[model samples]
Target: MNKHLLADRVKALTPSSTLAITAKAKELKAQGVDVIGLGAGEPDFNTPDHIIEAAYESMKAGETKYTPAAGTADLKKAVSQKFEKDQHIAYSPDEIFVGSGAKHVLYCLFQAILNEADEVIIPTPYWVSYPEQVKLAGGTPVYVEGKESNHYKITADQLRAAATEKTKAIIINSPSNPTGMIYSKEELSSLAEVCVENNILMVSDEIYEKLTYGEEKHISIASISEEFKKQTIIVNGVSKSHSMTGWRIGYAAGEKAIIKAMTNLASHSTSNPTTTAQFGALAAYTGTQQPVEEMRAAFEGRLNQVFDSLNAIQGFRCLKPQGAFYLFPNVKEAAVSCGFTTVDEFAADLLEKANVAVIPGSGFGSDDNIRLSYATDLKSFKEAIKRIAAYVNEHSSASD
Candidate 1:
């Protein structure tokens, strides 16, 4: 028998749907077709000036070589201080592990913690990588739906029901990707209680912590109590908060054993995050936070300005997002009205016909919904919404 060219694990991984859609949009743009893409997950803004300056200064000062497998002490210290200041939860440098990016840190974490057939419970409407990561680590992904009626949040009772002897961890993403929904303090308290009782690790992805708006606040599950803190591992970075996505600096904070294990795994893989980028991240935490808030205010303004317009399209229903830059609207009705049987088809048609690109929510584990990002400029975002509205009006049948 002929051997397979690739490992089974590699074959099983799903290509990132966000990136695929963005690539198609770029392909059309290359051909001179006007395409407004709402598929990008990162902020469209450039890195803050001080951050860039800090990286440049570090490079000039001969900080090019790596200092540790986990991270430089100064960078880890900055992260520790950041956790103290932002989450009100303290983490020593020993408990922190920095990797090239949050995605890389998460990959390292699953590698260190997961064993064959171990199960990780992930909420549906999750970030696309969670299940694939678990599978790559030789673990099974048990999904619990985060019902839209509950603002797309899974309840504590549902979590308890999902736990089993093999269940090792659960991820909680506040100001969630795709949906832009945040879990409230009371909701987190309930879920944390369940995790503690069941001895399940809580992986809190707080990369979007600084991007919340209005009355909604991002809360770290680790901040509820010392016991909860021990059970939770926080993954956050400057990528979203400071628009430093390309800088690739993200960290994890948790129990010493897990952090040490992740550090060891990272040593063999990425070694350390980019030395210059670490300095930029350090500056991001210690420097003035004015630019962070400035970006947050811009997102809020765009959300307010275009939300009503997007929500008013025929047969569309969008929950007002409290945080994050993406709007997830359930487009099942719209798809059916437009004579498309699936949201994916509708999304493709929008890209082809209306020249607007959106990420079909099927990739995020919700087939009925679609994600639209307001991370682009206000003018383009508004125009994209208008195009979508116009397309639906023209194609949708009133009798259907």
Candidate 2:
């Protein structure tokens, strides 16, 4: 029980705030409270039927053993073909490394590349895991504000300024997590130029690639050019796109050496991604593109349904997200107007009183905002927003 018994890395870890809020919501639900949770990042849909069948068929065929550390050859081939078809880019099997999930693949990547005191540039309003994972790899995370005015995106000048002699990598999460903003091709070209000029590695997280709405398309920085491709490692999977979160199959594609290092690390640590899950992902990439589109359309519909209601809440200011399912709204004014001192306290009261569970943005390094996911059904999402609006109206002290 002694604190000194734990490794320093374990001691330094920050738990995922998204998971913490989701767990609290589940706890309230178990108590028979009508809590509507907007904290979850994964799609609410079940894994597509064909992908489920593929896993079942693999199990029946006795394909339950461990795969190669990176992934199965056939699955890798399918992933390679997917890149070619979707991005107009080519990656050989050796250039790809698969792991239990995109999260795990990224962890392995930092472990493979980082040394003590190396820095990873992380833009604010980032995915919670990025900074934590960087620290776990003994790397320091340098933060740059992705001003909300710029649609929560960091500029190439910001990227160049954040880099130093010890800078090892920089992450670009287009169709970003908390804000759901997509970077344009010209924006990416400028950022890619910075990385190329500095010889800095670009860690592009494209897990939300298939979930973009309207005319906004997802662009991979690696697809920009051969030089950019050489400087980038893409982290992506079926978790969001195919509703395969529990299936735990994700992959990284990049230079052969880095992929090999990540593969070797996986061999020692994870052994391999689950065999059946790999087959399921193979089918996800090769099977009908219908289910992916269906889910995206549904999310877009929900976003359209509740966005106005959300923004209409007193003191709430939100930008319409171009992609992903989350709405990141700056709620500091709302919190203050509602007689609370901090967004965290305001969020706590919402859960306790309004029965709506939203993630406070303090966990994402942006304390003025909160994130609400539309991954749930339209009915629940609408009701949650309504509850939040009513709570704000009842508690407002602006007239005072």
What is the TM-score of each predicted model, taking all chains together? 0.98, 0.99
> Compared to the true structure, candidate 1 yields what TM-score?
0.98
Model 2 residue 353 lDDT score: 99
- Spell out the clash pairs found in candidate 1: none
Model 2: per-residue Cα lDDT at residue 206: 96
- The residue-by-residue lDDT of candidate 1 on 305-374, one tens digit each, is 9999999999889999988899999999999999999999999999999999999999999999999999
What lDDT does model 1 reach?
A: 0.93
lDDT values of the candidates? 0.93, 0.95
**Residue 332 miss distance in model 1 (angstroms):** 0.4
Per-residue lDDT over 1-400 for candidate 2, one digit per residue giving the tens place of the 0 to 100 score: 9868999998899999999999999999999999999999999999999999999999999999988999999999999999999999999999999999999999999999999999999999899999999999999999999999999999999998889999999999988999999999999999999988998999999999998988879999999899999999999999999999999999999999999999999999999999999999999999998999999999999999899999988899999999999999999999999988899999999999999999999999999999999999999998999899889988989745
Displacement of residue 161 (Cα, Å) in model 2 is 1.5
